[model samples]
Target: MANQTEVLRLLMANAPEYCSGDRLADELNISRTAIWKMVQGLQTAGYSIESRHGRGYRYVENNQLSVAGIQNGLDITPAVQLIVLPSVDSTNAYLKRMATRTPLTEPVVVVADSQTAGYGRSGRTFYSPGETGIYLSIGLPVTTDQPLDAGLLTTSTAVVVAQTLRQLFDVPVELKWVNDVLVNHHKVVGIMSEGITNLETGQISTVVVGIGINLTTAAFPSPLQSKAGAVLAHPTKVTRNQVIRQLLRTFFERYPSYRSGDFMPLYRQLSMVINQRVSLKSGARTYDGVVLDIAQTGALVVQLTDGRVQEFSSGEITKVNLLTGQYHG
Candidate 1:
């Protein structure tokens, strides 16, 4: 019997035209019942599937999360293995377990339609609700020729996401210190990167970048109602699959430019922190500073209030009101 991926490929490949059950079953060597089940599963995942009594099933359209839809016209192939799930606790957590179980030979991208335990920097829960947000993690193993710049992948990814949103929606997107994407003073996306290192060789064994994006406008919990923003404030035909394709396409195709810091100029252009007075935190200590510049190595260079200069690579920029440019909750 064929899997859901194959079934979806067939349906999406022949959109607006129904594929007979018998023919689909014969092609996949699965029973008609199995085909019916697969179609039900796809429908449950937010795909728009139309059915008729004897016409079998036809794909009406997909403005939702569809792996087959994502793979259909995405030209950047051979770089990452894409895995889509209807739901997962967290794509980052899933990838960590996967890398731990079997050493990956190539890069792997895992995307979830929704995340249950989605989290961000500082172990805070990332507000991820169903059918409207994107939670993805790209696992990069040391096996690929792409040299791992442990310091900048998160920063580079921020650039890619910010650019993707701006290119698709023509909205002004801004980047907070490390990995937050903002618009209209609300955070629409959060990025977190985790990695394991080979202690003996002092090399990275695996690294995963988790990106959680509020794709469409949806109600949020009372706590996050003020800060979490959606990429599309209103409705549109833009789907999660389309956004994923554009992001992955640019991320891999321009791997060198981003990974090597050549994309810093654009990163700077979208930065919301430059020249802003900010609060910083490093381990048990905290300080206040005025942003100076983003170093070539993707560090935040700051001129401390105490007449000292400091650079932060992995430290947190203490929560400042993104809207008012003041240090607050």
Candidate 2:
């Protein structure tokens, strides 16, 4: 039988039109029985395929994720390669391990259908159920000349993701300071950035930005039920590949601005915490303050109730209360 990727490509290329069993078998160099089995596999994998008695198979218009469809949608340069995995432990971990073994030539983007050991900021387990979310990581080389601020990278990523989601779905997407994207005040996206630095010069050599988005997830773990959310409220016609392609396009387009610290302005505009009463947790200590602004370097500037203004470069913003005067996580 033809592999799932190849089968998908053939169906997508001739979408809305049935490709006869004889044609599929001849083109794939397989038997008609093999074609039937492959169609069953595609249906099992969430593709909506309709098989008629005489018309053969037709690829229905549905929200199924397709690697070929996504690759066709992307206008990325040939130097950048996109790899889609049926399953993986984690895209970030996979790319990080690959970086250690081989010298990465060009930018490599690894996207998985699901992650078994997906993680987020501070080692939190990012809920990554299969076939419902986008798990992607980009491995790119960065030198001292184009220095990247690790703090700004995650925030800038959130900005671009929020912008893309808003433009695509025409929904209200907001950025929760530092690494989370929220819609309707519920988190829908989480981002993490890991890099290797030169010990001598204290500059980063390579950086991998990992992003996980809950696209059409219907449920979450009990612990995250109240905090987590998917971007789409209803099952629309958006496919996973479309989301992946648009995200990559937006990220690369805005990446130069992120390197130049120009994304801070848009980050401030999409911020959910700014001007809101917030509770920040740093280690065992907690501070209650109102977020005044986000610094150019991506730090959260806050003014405490006791009339002291402080800048927090790293901390967990446990809670943000837009309506209430007091905030608690």
Worst 10 residues of 2 by lDDT: 320-329
Best by TM-score: 1
What does candidate 2's lDDT look like per residue over 71-114, in tens digits? 75477653577788888888999988887676466788998888
Quick one: how many clashes does candidate 2 have? 0
Clashes of each: 0, 0
Q: Which stretches of candidate 1 lie above 4 Å from their native place?
A: 1-4, 14-46, 51-58, 143-146, 198-202, 319-329
Q: Tell me model 2's lDDT, rounded to 2 decimals.
A: 0.83
TM-score of 2: 0.83
CA error at residue 93 for candidate 2, angstroms: 1.3
lDDT of 1 by residue, 172-257 (tens): 68888787898777789999888866666776788898999898858988898877788877876777788899999988876655
lDDT of each: 0.83, 0.83
Cα deviation of 306, candidate 2, in Å: 3.2
